[model samples]
Target: MLSQKAKYALQALLALAELDEGDSLMIGDIAEKQRLPKRFLEQILLDLKHQGVVQSWRGKNGGYALLKSADKITFGEIVRIIDGPLAPLPCLSRMAYRKCDDCVDEERCAVRRVFASVHDATTEILDSMTLTRALNGGEVRELLRGTG
Candidate 1:
């Protein structure tokens, strides 16, 4: 399951992708528009800024904006940043690997193989999707639910 932080991060990014021309947005504005809490939004944006996914501006007209093109940022990247890994289990994870302790036959684990396929499919979907694509794909509600 995607954490709230991950979902909020994506929502905020999609909101910015609507105007991905390197313009800043007040954190409060993104919160209200995306139906997220102000302080929480601020924290997520801060973390994203730290990751260099988004940049911040300071002053009367300051807030947040994508550091890179919205089309260049992948959902998988952000999800990895926020949720840690895309795989269902640590042993199945390619990016963040950790062998399971109790597994007797990791070499022939059918469940691990199944999860690997699922992870691969998920990776394919998210890697191909960018914030701009999600925003331009359809209405915000549909995009959030990932179906229209």
Candidate 2:
């Protein structure tokens, strides 16, 4: 499940992505436009800025904006930043993998095998999806329908 914080972060980023290049949006404006909590959005933006996903300006005309192009920012990156590893279990995690104490043979563990497949598929999809694709609602739907 995606955390509310991560979901909000993506929403905020998408909104910023819609703006012209080099344009910044104030937190109040973002919260009002996206129907998000202003205080919560401030924190999310701070975290994003710290991670280099966004850059902040501190002045009268300052706000938040993407540090990179929309296509360069993957959903996987945002999710991992806000929600930690995407793996269902620590044993299946690539970034934070830990062997189960009770599992003697990871190679033959049926649970691990099943979840590993699921994790691989999920990771591939999320990593491949960028904010640009997400913003293109019509094109994305058409592409998905065609793929299906």
Candidate 3:
């Protein structure tokens, strides 16, 4: 399941993608438009900025904007940034793998195998998806079809 913070981050990015390039969106405007809390968004945006995913400006027109084009950012990347690894189990995580404490033999672990499959498929879908495609109403099936 996606965390509330990750969902809010995606919403904020998608909202920013809707605007023209070089346009900055105020945190308050994003909160009202995306129906997220102002304080919460401030923290999320700060984290994103720290990750270099978004840039911030100060003053009357100051707010936040994507550091680059939407197509350059993947849902998987942001999800991992906000929610950590996408693997269902630690053993299945490519970036943060750890053997199951109770497992006798990872090679014979059926549970790991099943979860590995799930992790692979999930990663494939999420990694391939960009905010650009999503903002244009592209669906996962459509992205899989290479139409978006």
Specify the highest-lDDT model's number.
Answer: 3
- Number of the top-ranking candidate, with TM-score as the measure: 3
lDDT by residue (tens digit), candidate 2, 1-148: 9999999999999999999998999999999999999999999999999999999898998999999999899899999999999999789988899999899899999999999998987787778778988887534344444451
Please list the C-alpha lDDT of all candidates, in the order they appear. Answer: 0.85, 0.89, 0.91
lDDT per residue as tens, model 1, 1-148:
9999999999999888877475788988999898999888888998999999998889997878889998899898999999898989899877778899888888799999998888877887787788777766734454446573
Give candidate 2's TM-score.
0.91
TM-score-superior candidate, 1 or 3? 3
Tens digits of per-residue lDDT for model 3, 1-148: 9999999999999988887888899999999999999999999999999998999899998888999889888999999999999999988887899988899999999998988888887898899888998887778886667665
Each candidate structure's TM-score, on Cα atoms with residue i matched to residue i, is: 0.89, 0.91, 0.95
The collision pairs in model 2 are none
- The C-alpha stretches of model 3 lying farther than 4 A from their native spots are 145-148
Worst 10 residues of 2 by lDDT: 139-148
Q: What lDDT does model 2 reach?
A: 0.89
Q: Which stretches of candidate 1 lie above 4 Å from their native place?
A: 138-148
